[model samples]
Target: MACNKSFSSNYFLLTPEEVGFFDLIHILFSTTKFEEGIKFLDMSKFVSKPLSELGSGIEVALNLIPSNRNVFVFMLNFLRGRAVKPDKTSATFLSFIGLIDKRVELDGSIKHGDANYHAALSAMASKASYENSACIETIVKNHWKMKFLGFYDFWNDYQGKATTQAFLLRDKTCDQDTIVVAFRGTEPFDADAWCTDFDFSWYELYGAGKIHGGFMKALGLHKNDGWPKEEVKQDGKPPRPRAYYAIRDMLNKLLRQNDESRYIVTGHSFGGALAILFPAILAMHDEAWLLERLQGVYTFGQPRVGDEKFGEFMEKQLKEHRVPYFRIVYGNDMVPRLPFDDNALMYKHFGTCLYYNRHYEVKVVEEEPYRNYFSSLGAIPKMINAFWELIRSFTISYAKGPGYKEGWLLRIFRIIGLVIPGAPAHSTQDYVNATRLGSSDVFVPPKDI
Candidate 1:
């Protein structure tokens, strides 16, 4: 109930339709109907449709049945009977919407919070699919994969985590000093939802912490496939202490396995919030080991998870280990700017914020030389990031190349802009100005007077 005070019902994982459909489909296709469903998919006239179009169609179909979400998933299972490569279809779809980059652009019509990168998998749209053909193929494939896999119901292994047998992946090669962890965020149904497909075993969060041994009722902290929420906070702050211990024990076990590696923490969206907090929490619990071994943090689109007091405390905590930390934001993804009130100004302005927005911003610094320098300075790093994104986009840019939508450089820049911690093109300047996370510079705390 208290947690409800922080994240309203709107914030909970499921909408009424989603909840109904998920449970409903779980029942519908638990048997042969699943196979019949697949047979039905073959009914589509365009079996040979471009993979991207196939995926896009699925997406539109699923979205159309907003209330009957299960039908979309059932259709996927049904289609799989025809031996469609559901995972690849899903991966392609994921790549389309720019998930690989750690963010997904929510269409303006959907209106509200940006879709968490964890939700649907999509690839960049194919060139033909955009102008000449419907995006149905690309969207459908991803939706089918998600539905068949029961991704919408990610906490399928709560019993295992609670029973102390949760699914987790780890590596002993890491320095005992440099333990690394990546929070799986809200969803760990599978990898490849994002373009990175970050190493599962080494990353800790994805393969290691994911306790998805079976079906679950959804009440656990997501880092591992455990109980969603076991302890409630008496104080209105993010559950940092609880999460810290959960992480600390894991690192200790990892270090106990091999004594050489240090620690690094990272994640995307809410997971990113945990990544930043893990070290802070560890430092509080075991300062000696944590501080000495702490390497850095890199989170994308992390939400502000605390009250002003807790936020300030975390600010100092992270600063101590700030050198290696880098928070990447992408393209005005709104999920990153959540759960923060105006009580804390610095953080309100800078901390727990997204680097990008629909309309990019230009800010001026006091006694600072550059006019809108953050935006100006930010442009270069984004361009650099875009270069790599071009490679990824090449797989799916369905738009005509050489135009704004089609140009390799421009399209990929938008893709890169989605995942980097700071918004592409401007927010890196904000990072530059940030004393705690950016390059070290002597900072006099702003006078509260």
Candidate 2:
């Protein structure tokens, strides 16, 4: 299947200013002091202008900083006494920060806007699933109606010792017992995450080539071994991703212990890719009981995982089991269209895509349009088209500023493949906004079923 061409609903939309405000908040929480943090915010131009006008200033600043430096430090050094210059806007912003700080101290979560506005905005918090201590802390304290149960960190030995992280969360206020598996996405500023993000080499898996080798290794599958001999034809099947064995073992124990609990898997970006593959692996191995207990799989800005055959396999299994796989796409999120949509590359996306248009309208479609192969030209057209779309989207959203649109600036940046650290549409908070609004009417299967 190819990309969806339409949206399903128009529920809520986050304004450019509001996007800037949240971006500012993320920046503030990630800094050491109000002054220091505000300095970066000022540099990003995210402090005074809408993010659409200035682009993601936070991402640009993050690109310049060292990767080892912790990006999300929650401590706020409130500037008091005569040294402080109090202005109305700064005062109001500080007051807002103070409120968030209070909420963090009190309940570990801060509400984004008014509760009655929309569920999406209401459910957003500063929480993210990064490797940073502060990010983990915020997630532990926040994350709607869920309590942190445990964290699983896996190392990809095959892929230059890369690390992947996931969280196991349980419902804090459970009407029916539920366990949530959340995965962390690529960190725009972090070198490790960048490495993972760019490691797009394909490996053969389940009779298909072009599966991301790095991701396969990260999932705990090895080169020598293949999927369980009983499951697939052993001729040349690649091993399961390396890290998944430990994860599967853990989930096995959990499922055995709580037979009645429903499991929901979720992630953003790269993590979203993992979330999609996790269940597919389980189902492929004929783990029927585990598949039955799976309530739903939700992903935000997930890239295409495998070829058309892989997608077909996944869709069939998921549909037969009645599992609702929601692939949430935000406005012009380049990641979803990535690893290049070339037919030769053999990459295809699975599940129902719920795309949020430029207006943040929700469009639901079964699959994206398939790009047909054209002789030796292969997927070049598709690749170029996807890349151009990304460039166009990025340009419209971020390159409209004074110096950004200049001829030399555009040409140089294009030649160097310079990218703004984070895509605004792909931000975790943006996903939260979309999901909260879209999931209001979603049905949650019973635990006993």
Candidate 3:
């Protein structure tokens, strides 16, 4: 694909779809570069060397597993029944992650005035974002006693389908009424979503630095045109509405209706990345009205989205807007530790990191201990922590109460952690636990946005 005039000139994008089995093998030996192996990387100012090569390698590796068509078909046939059934919310392999902690009501201990109240609320909303519209509506309206705004599945310009999902809810108490927008994260059975996570493509904005290209596409990045302040009109049939534009319009209407209404964006995993990026785009467009009304941003197990420069830009934007940005990481959860914060990749995490250990101990840090997950020295400790977590699952209920109990499914997942240490730690259950059980002091709420 040729570079569009409006698109960023400096970018490195990889398309795993173009890689054949032989071409996948060619990634390892980069000496004789195969021009047709990966398409998109040949664009002007973007080469298929080293960085894009590494990204292509990662994408190909993921494609060989459940992220491919064959595995997806097998998984769907095996898990399809779960999706159709009323009891099961999703057909994804990790659907059981949401089932581990089924508690819908906010913790009674965390009162409305408590510092952790919004964090706890946001965590539950993030978890609920993974479920279907029916489940979300029931939980919000009946259990939480909140107003269900709407659930949306938005289009991804690059992927050519509606792959992004999010829902909005309004929680009004006697003291305040806040709007919560929760984005759905990667699903295990979704090849497209997995491809998105594995794709390390990036686009460098004029001043914002380099942002993840896959995420930008997922969050309404137009193919030909970069982010124009206003949505571009499509000729012939109107294209599907994107997540950014669509959500922005919805927020404008909602905030206009009530002068006091404020909104916060949140999500888990891939959703978390989108949650933080939502406001960055708002800041880019200089949406003073929405930025002023943006209460805070809370992300759980969010992956690194940009370089150090991008991080600095985001820090300035968030600080100038007076937005409280909280990045929650539970133990060695692997998602937050990527895409590697090394010289080669240059991805970094900024903002306050509320790091929670296995015992739900909270530590406010600039970044998590192990910024990269692939360290040889850290491997043993991560495994030890994983083993301890498995043991803790059985006895956590006795210590914390019945609400903290782990189910058989979660135990099975914990067992898998033995093989892949940080995998189980990325679950929504632990994040929910962190918000509810962890200290409230970590939350730095400014006087007002």
Candidate 4:
């Protein structure tokens, strides 16, 4: 689990493949040979027994999910494939890509300066990112009336495969053409993508603070070489094109061609993590030119990405650059309230948190209520809320019109949420609904900061 020292002098790395059940149990009794499963550059500064036990237990439980997910997805697809045409696009465990809403057109009435317009557009783009290239291209060009720049599957050095996915599109308005980059989130059955969420390995940079190792890797963190200012090329081409370098180059060319054009970064769930992290890297590399043109960043159900120090660094950078970051959390969506903001993993979220309830009422808070999902006091209320959400699934269209209708696939997930409340709340449908139905006043920046 040893990483390149030049990037992070202090790091706690985990190689799940190297872990055994007995080794995990041993962590509860003793610290000896813990390095056999977990790697540390220098953990002695504050390595506690509770932290070790918690880390081991977390790895074991979360690892089971991805292992079981693979089989479940295979069985699901196999059964569905018999009755219908084989899905060419990425399909989640419960939902078919084709069956979900394909509407990409924005609201004709909602204009610029209103956050609803951009939020709705970005949410749709985020959902589109989950589909295949042809599907994404079709929606962007034919439905949204926008230009589809490109779609990519970028290389992740840790996964030893292209694990990250994103797309670029250009929207021409009356005043200026805006470039949008949408990063895809974790798919229900994609084990590799889920691993990115579950893997809690961390790296502590000199001034930037500790960051999630999985995300950095997904965002083109090279194996031996860290975030080099320039894209590293092998022979004539990159060994495999990485996301940060490739997108940075694309933006540089696209932005220069139109001086009036500015760009925005956006995503949902795991994609949201990448969305915010992308700007952090730009600031880290001192890419003032790119930062100046960065209009905003919008994320839905994004997880906590870094330690408090990292949060401070990003807040300062964003404030200095005058870039607004809106982190939208819908209802009890559990993704926004993790990896537990505790001593074991010191991750903390920064910036405006636009938290929405079942009615799509937004509350702008520094942090979402119940900062951790595993709260005993919030359990009963969350379940009651989940019950209401399930009922609303049948009645929302009637209340909010046909456009707000919930699909059968999503309804099934809502039923599952009765037992596990926040799981279903994390869907893109609710986030989209929140943008359209919720108040735009939540987008107004607070002066106190």
lDDT of each candidate versus the true structure: 0.33, 0.50, 0.80, 0.80
Ranking by TM-score: 3, 4, 2, 1
Candidate RMSDs in Å, in order, are 17.9, 16.7, 8.1, 8.3
Q: Write the per-residue lDDT of candidate 4 for residues 1-449, one digit (tens) a residue.
A: 55464777677676654545454334323424223138322221234344545544543343332334555764575577632223344222112332444345566667776757678889888888887788788778887889999999999987778889999999888887889999999876566677688666778877999898889989998777788898767568756889998999899999999889999999999999999999999998999999989988999999999999999999999999899899999999999988878666677999889999999999989999888887889999999999999999999989988777887767888999999989999988888888888998877656743
Cα lDDT tens digits for candidate 1, 254-282: 66655565555555554555555555445
What RMSD value applies to candidate 2? 16.7
CA error at residue 98 for candidate 3, angstroms: 2.5
Residue 113's lDDT within candidate 3 is 73
lDDT of 2: 0.50
Which portions of model 4 show Cα errors greater than 4 Å? 1-3, 20-84, 87-103, 234-237, 445-449
lDDT of 2 by residue, 1-449 (tens): 22121221111111122233455344323323222112111122322235322333443332221222232321121222222222322212222112112222212222323221122311222224443433444445553545666666676654435468776756533345566677777754344555455444444454333355445555654434444523222358643334466567666687676657777777778888887788877876788877888877777778877767777778788877877777877655557866555533446776667765543447666643332222224244444443553465346435433211223323333333323312444555345545434443332333422
> Tens digits of per-residue lDDT for model 3 on 168-206?
999897778799999999865565676677666778898
Per-residue lDDT, model 4, residue 445, is 58
State the lDDT at 270 in candidate 1: 43
